[model samples]
Target: MARPLKDPTGAELARLNLNVQARFKAAAKAKAQTHGMTLTDYLEGLIAADISDLQAATGIQEALIPKSA
Candidate 1:
């Protein structure tokens, strides 16, 4: 069986902790009915929209700049 690698660095771990806390807070606020859907759903929707925008922008950029090589 393969063994696990070393733990994350302090800064990386702190960032992860902050992210988790932020999500938890968002979920709690969502539970209070501040937003329409749950935190998970809200994040998913936001991520999907972000990806769509990225794709559209990339396509426009490609059209404006011809591919070389």
Candidate 2:
């Protein structure tokens, strides 16, 4: 039986504009492909993990979360 799709993270997203060297971009793309992940998924995983680490180190969870408008 198939289940209905749901919002994966249930959080709104904001655009991130990064400027990296061409080599770095290609390296990240290759790493994502090697791990069988789309570049977007791989980058999201990385950012989320980093944020979790930062939250743990700083003990300021609210600071990391986006401010509600």
Tens-digit lDDT track for model 2 on 5-61? 322344344567889999999999887766565566557556656776644643234
Q: TM-score for every candidate vs. truth?
A: 0.32, 0.56
Model 1 per-residue lDDT tens digits across residues 1-69: 111132212222111222467777766656534434444434433444567663354332222221121
lDDT of each: 0.38, 0.53
Q: How many residue pairs clash in all the candidates, one count each?
A: 0, 0
Worst 10 residues of 1 by lDDT: 1-10
How close to the true structure is residue 54 of candidate 2, measured as C-alpha lDDT?
Answer: 42
Q: Estimate candidate 2's RMSD in Å.
A: 10.6
